[model samples]
Target chain A: GAGVSQSPSNKVTEKGKDVELRCDPISGHTALYWYRQSLGQGLEFLIYFQGNSAPDKSGLPSDRFSAERTGGSVSTLTIQRTQQEDSAVYLCASSAPGSNQPQHFGDGTRLSIL
Target chain B: ELKVEQNPLFLSMQEGKNYTIYCNYSTTSDRLYWYRQDPGKSLESLFVLLSNGAVKQEGRLMASLDTKARLSTLHITAAVHDLSATYFCAATQRAGGTSYGKLTFGQGTILTVHP
Candidate 1:
């Protein structure tokens, strides 16, 4: 794909089940970011991955959330023991590892925990 | 903590009307960005400001950054219904802050331009 792509555009799951959302960043982008947006709300920073830098998890809401970026190209956000409030749109954006680079975004996966 | 605040959280305007959204950050930063997101869609990059007194415009929208004051503004000129959406202003935190090389976003302004 020419742009960032996120899989499972929409997902529904039980409250106790674990779910995974995938993000494929734009080619050659060395930085990846994950954010969560509740319905009709602003974005909340979740995690970030920068080239050769330690992934920042300061923004993750709780211990139920985790993410990993492999080979600096793809990322996955995993939610463990999801609760009803865990439902939200998970957004992924990628940017060049330089300053002032415009971040490119994916459509995001709308996850619903029942 | 670095905080970003956006004023006029919601704006409703008649077609051809004008409005401006203000973004104020709690710390000093040199880079700012504006993004637009439609309902159920991803973010679209609108403008990137690199320094103080930087100004950029596209079609009906214009953005300016004032690094000294740690503020940015998104001005909507003669807004149309098509421009109605959520606009987000984000700033990169300084190296000394808790969020280094990380973007802190405002609460977002929901603009609804009625035609």
Candidate 2:
């Protein structure tokens, strides 16, 4: 089976521009999550979706960041007015519908703000 | 709020030696997870500890969790060059009906194994 897939493995954009990162979860995975990794911040959870509805969004850094999942399989994270601080690797993960199931991660999209 | 921390943020070990990475959480968690990531790569799930005494081993790596102490350990036995990577430990707290699968990750430990 194919693992989680992410598009635009690398994206370089000017500050204040908007960028959208996409994620394709594994087949039959109902739980999806977004995470960010940076040099200063090791790894941080951004949001979590359960069956198309996001139940947790507390991890989002600011109002400019938003994510949505459709059909419970694909998710997109959009960052508006990107800042130099927002430059990092955006990782998406998915897992089966279970309490303690481990999440499988995608290659991640590296976002760089120039 | 949940906080997870890992010690020895940087480790350099010799091949064939043994070492352990420690993870501690600030709150009670439903599960503990270990992940490995290579340079310019995403995380790879290593182990999931569900119980206080849960211990799992794969190849030269072993993981154990002590829920009572809110601690988890990833031990490398006879470290090899291939084990060089960043290791992360995450804890998830159960909320209401669904877990939501939100992970609180610790600062990763960068491990380097050399001959």
Best by lDDT: 2
Residue B82 in model 1: lDDT:
94
DockQ of each: 0.55, 0.79
Query: Clashing residue pairs, candidate 1?
Result: none
What lDDT score belongs to each candidate, Candidate 1 first? Answer: 0.87, 0.93
Cα lDDT over the full model 1: 0.87
For candidate 2, lDDT tens digit of each residue in A1-114? 999999999999999999999999999998999999998888899999988988889899999999999887899999999999999999999999778789999999999999
lDDT of 1 at B67: 86
B1-115 in candidate 2: lDDT tens per residue?
A: 8999999899999999999999999998859999999998899999999988999999999999998899999999999999999999999988558664688999999999999
TM-score of 1: 0.93
Query: How many residue pairs clash per model?
Result: 0, 0
- Interface RMSD for candidate 1 relative to the native interface: 3.2
State what share of the real interface contacts each candidate retains.
0.59, 0.82
Model 1 per-residue lDDT tens digits across residues B22-62: 99999877889999999889999999998899999999999
